[model samples]
Target: MAYLKERHLFPGGNTSKGFYSFYKYILSQEDGNRILCMKGSPGSGKSYFMKKIGAHFAAKGYTIEYHHCSSDNNSLDAVVIKELKLAILDGTAPHMVDPIHPGAVDEVLNMGEALDMDALFLNKKEIMEVQKKISKTFERAYRYFAAAKDIHDDWSSLNAESISTDKISTVTESLKEEIFHTQKSGYGADRHLFATAFTPNGIVTFAEDLVFGFENKFILNGGPGFGKTEIFKKIGSTAQRKGYFVEYMHDPLIPERIEHLLIPELSTCVLTTNEISQTSFTGKVYNIEDFCKADVIAANKEEVAYCSKIFYDLIEKGLSLITDAHTIHDELETFYISAMNFDVANDIFDKVVKKFEKFE
Candidate 1:
């Protein structure tokens, strides 16, 4: 009914590695929960199927999270209804639910069965050709991303070498006093996923929406590779020790590095800024530049400019290649869509929705 929805990525393509996955983190808050894993072809209505289910719950005032496909943001990798401990996902490539399909916790829903096999068989050769093209297109995209990553590393190293560990300690300690204030006896849960992704549309982040609901929101500003993650990690570690759950929204470029942190237990969130966010800070602002050597950054102005230009150019090329991949994907979808029997597919979707009604 209301505009109450959140978007995230389960599997994201990036510069560091070709395909990165955080699908396991979807609905990870609770195990043994009901999971409806959809098995289908490209245009088998998997995304459309999930959309209807998500809308149904949202109309009832249920806040849902759509785990969008990084390659094609319009499609979903998963839909999480945390309160119901239920999720319906496109259990397909890149984010395949596991080698066993549904695994032990998930219940399989096969939309592939609704396909008109005779029709698909007629286009078998065309389908294979398009699928092969899609694979090659993505490979080209990853090559460009790989090239960009090298330059980015060189750029980051320029600032990283001059970081002040002592200053980092000082600010983080202040954060502990200012944010945590007290400690708990036990440890807290830590969940990980990407808050931002490098898609065909370029770098996309839902940081504002992800953190908007928090009453206490903070933005961390700093130079590249300085101490953004270090600060967030410090805050997250401190939150965990103080019995608070932390959601570490990692960087798409460097999956290991956190770009943002969420501490819902404290109704607080602290995220890095710049191209990643546009939200006005409602809480404290920690500038990582304050923790790094100013003169070192000053000296590397030329290097920063040089590396930045090359890195961004290479990244743009990669985005174009990814766009090619998306185009190829559209062609592949057409084959399946042509063979799809929506009347039968909708019947299957209706039955699946019925099974999930108890949760509503």
Candidate 2:
């Protein structure tokens, strides 16, 4: 059986503002049917376990949303089966989530329960030392990121002044018409996630896959501070007010700002090209720079170049620090991996899948 697959990031971690999370979006009984919070140390097979369960249901034609980790794109932070209204998430620190309706709507799946106590006990000191390094390394990376954001903001202020506010609506008029041609009035909902992340390895994005097969697309391409995200917000809010569900994929570096919008009901999407999103969009490609006076940007090119160099350099420094930190984290994981029994974990994985097999 063939099924639909989607990917996103919940808590996007970066240097600009440290870590920004959308974990509260994990709705339980009132929102969804069930939520499974997996408790375990790093490299304890939580991601793999979740994948196994997702695969089982997807094979039966269920639509699955795989939430990838910001720091590690290869790893998953959560697995959501929309058809079942069920989700499984990594319940660890940084973005820790506890059950709002334990037992009733939420359940804890603890992998540590099957750990070899003697093995972990013998390696406790090593784990402590590695943990210290990871924390400190992240701190250093954040500093670099903060500096880069400050510089980036300064550079963007120059371009922001030249934008034609009135033309914004004109540019988006076609998109507005396309999205609301057959609209219903009432209240709708919105969910926030990330389509890209500033990972230790580098910028990892799933933009192409997320927007794949959509009938219509409105894409923006230009430099920062050109009102790209604001365009997304305007269309997104209007869509919501019209009783349409919208999935907002935010900027990983600036999590508060959205970079893309997906309205599944309409089979339409809107987005902007950015440093983080490596997606090459097809459809109406609107150049955001068109709204800005070319002469003004040309005059400020030197300063823009200066700021751009430093901003990206600082970003590179941050990524380097994060990479180093993860290298140390890998060492820390070795201890946990050595102490865990794969056979027991696999058994637990099977039981978790079995519970969902009976779901309507």
Tens digits of per-residue lDDT for model 2, 288-318: 7887788988888888889889888988898
- Cα displacement (angstroms), candidate 1, residue 360, comes to 4.7
Compute each candidate's TM-score over C-alphas: 0.92, 0.95
Residue pairs in candidate 1 whose N, alpha carbon or C atoms collide under 3 angstroms: 1-59
For candidate 1, lDDT tens digit of each residue in 1-360? Answer: 122355555445454688887767777625636788788899999998888888887777676888878888777888877567788877777667642334556778889888998999998899999989988888888888788778877888998877888988888888777677556678988888876777767677776677766777677776567767777877888788888778888877667778778887677778777433233555788778777888988999899899988977887888888888898899899889988889998899788777777655
- Model 2 clash count equals 0
Off by over 4 Å in 1: 1-11, 29-32, 99-104, 183-185, 274-282
Q: Give the Cα error of residue 290 in candidate 2, in Å.
A: 1.3
